[model samples]
Target: MNSAKKFFQNLAKYLAVALLVFIIVSPIYWILVCSFKPTRELIRVTPTFVPHTVTLFHYVGLLKETGFMTYFLNSIYVATGSAVLVVILTSLAGYSVYRCRYLGRRFFFNILLAIYIFPRVLLLLFLYPMFARLNLVDNLLSLVITYVGITAPLNVWLMRAFFTSVPLELEDAALVDGANRLQILFKIFLPLVAPGIAAVAINSFLMSYGEYLFASILIVSDRFKTLPVGMAQFLQQYEISWGWLASGSVLIILPPVIAFAFVGRYFVKGLTAGAIK
Candidate 1:
């Protein structure tokens, strides 16, 4: 009787998990199906769950007819630049805060947390005028800088937590062996906190990649617009290009999905390590 009860319990858990997975993946599946369906099928009174006729016309149109490739390249440039800057700056700042004894260290740490907690809209409101004054508006560099500033605080905090987990004894031993601060930092400390760096890089990249408000507001030139802003073009005053929108949506989500698949283990480890410390 106990064995039977255990088996039933396990079956119930599996069923619940399967249901959750279906709910989460249903929208993605719908989008994929719609992307392949023709416009007539898409706008039909009765919607089809599965496409009878698969078409690559929408994807081809998006690439050739639209500025999709330009938008894609712009997004890649900004996101990659912002991620690298954030990781480099945050790693060094986090190490200093964690390892060094300095004036107002606690105060600086508190400020970082406060900035992270604050609403981003407030910052954007203040930053827009400054960017305009500096002629940074409608530029890719502007997006890169804004994204780095927005993502850096949380990443710095995360890196600090990771640094705290590294053994001080190891650093002391390195120092006694005549290794300087930079050598110890680059060689010993960095490798141990690599997972944290990966987590920061992933977070920064995704945030910049998907960010809509800043991208839309700051970038007025079509040539400088990122993928998120470009995708909005499909929804015009008269008609919405559902096929193109769906296809673009698929492309937008693919990069992050691929990135997570590659470094997902390190990302999870870094986040968990920060939480525990």
Candidate 2:
């Protein structure tokens, strides 16, 4: 009787969770279906769950007619660049903090954490004006630098936590065998902690990709605009093309989805590595 009762309880919990998942995913599934339909079918009084006849016209127009391709490429560049830079710099910073015995290390880490706790939006007011003074606005390089700085702190903190779980005796053994700090890091430590690095990369990529406020404020020219900003302009007050808008939205979400799907295991491993230990 007890086993039978437990079985039904577990079944009830699974059904509830499944329903919640369906609710969350339903809107995105609808958007994908609408992207294939035309403008008229998108807003018909009768809503259709699945489109009858699919049209590639909206996708084609966004690709060829509008500057969507340029924006898409820019987003790829910025996100990729920022993710790589953050992974490299933050790994080194984290290793130094976790593995080294430098003076005032705790103090430096405390200050760094405090900065991260402070909202980035607050920093934007000061940074935008300073960049304007230096004529750094509207430059891809400046945007890249800004992204790196913003993504670095949290990555460093997370990685530092992960690295704390690594055995220091391994480094000591390598050092006794005449290996230098850089050699030990490149050869022994990095390979073992690769999961954490991958997680940091994914986090940085998402942050850079979804960054709308900074991209909107910093970029002026249509050519240098990222996907987020382009999407904003795609939606306007008077006329919102549901089909075309949905198409653009689908296109915007594709890269991140593909990226996460590919690196998913690595991301999970990295984020949850030392978290369990």
Candidate 3:
């Protein structure tokens, strides 16, 4: 009786998990399928679960006609640049908060956290005037700077948490062996918290890549527009280009998905480590 009950319980647990996975993945699968379906098939009265006629027309049109490649490259540049800056800056800040015995360190950390209290639109309103004065309003650099600013606070907090999780004994031992501050930081602390850095990098990249609000407002030039803003061209005043939109969505989401796939383990470990600490 006990064995039977345990088996039944396990079966129920697996069933529930399968259901949740299906719910989460079904939309993504549907979108991928739809992107390949021909326009006529797409608008059929009876929706096809799978495309009967798969074609690359949407993808080809998206690439050739709509300046998709330009937007994609621009997005890659901004996202990669912001991610690198965020990781470097946040790692330094996190280390400072962890190691330095300074007055009001706690207050400083709190101030960083306080940045999130204000809405992004409100921040952008203030930031736009400053950028305009500096002649950075329509530049890709403006997007990079804005993304870094928005993403840094949380990353700094996460890095600090990761730093705290490292034992002080390691630093002390390195110091005893005549390792200088930079050496100790590079050789000891960094490797230990690598997962945290991976997590931070992924977060920053995704945030900057998909950010439409700031990108649209800051970038006026069609050539400088990122993927999100460029994709919005499909939405005309009258008719929506559902095919282009669906194909664009698939492409837009691919990078982040691929990124997470590679570093997802580290990302999970980093978050759990920070949470525990």
TM-score of each: 0.93, 0.91, 0.93
Off by over 4 Å in 2: 1-7, 273-277
Poorest lDDT segment (10 consecutive residues) of candidate 2: 268-277
Clash statistics: count for each candidate: 0, 1, 0
Local accuracy of candidate 2 as per-residue lDDT tens digits, 1-277: 9999999999999999999999999989989998999777888999889898799988987787677899999999999999999999988888888888889988877766776676778777877887898898886666778888888877876675458778989999999999999999989998887877877898899889889878888888989999989878867633776766888999998988988997777667655664565
Better of 2 and 3 by TM-score: 3
- Model 3: per-residue lDDT, tens digit, 228-248? 888886456337767887898
In candidate 1, what are the lDDT values of residues 1-277, reduced to their tens digit? Answer: 9999999999999999999999999999999999999999999999999998999988998888788899999999999999999999888888978888999999987887787577878878978899999999988998999999888888876675567878899999999999999999999999998988988899899999989989988999889989998878645633778888889889888998999888767667767767774
Find the candidate with the highest TM-score and give its number: 1
Arranged by lDDT with the best first, the candidates are: 3, 1, 2
Task: Give the C-alpha miss distance for residue 174 in model 2, angstroms.
Answer: 1.4
Kindly report which residue stretches of model 1 are placed more than 4 angstroms away from their true locations once superposed.
none
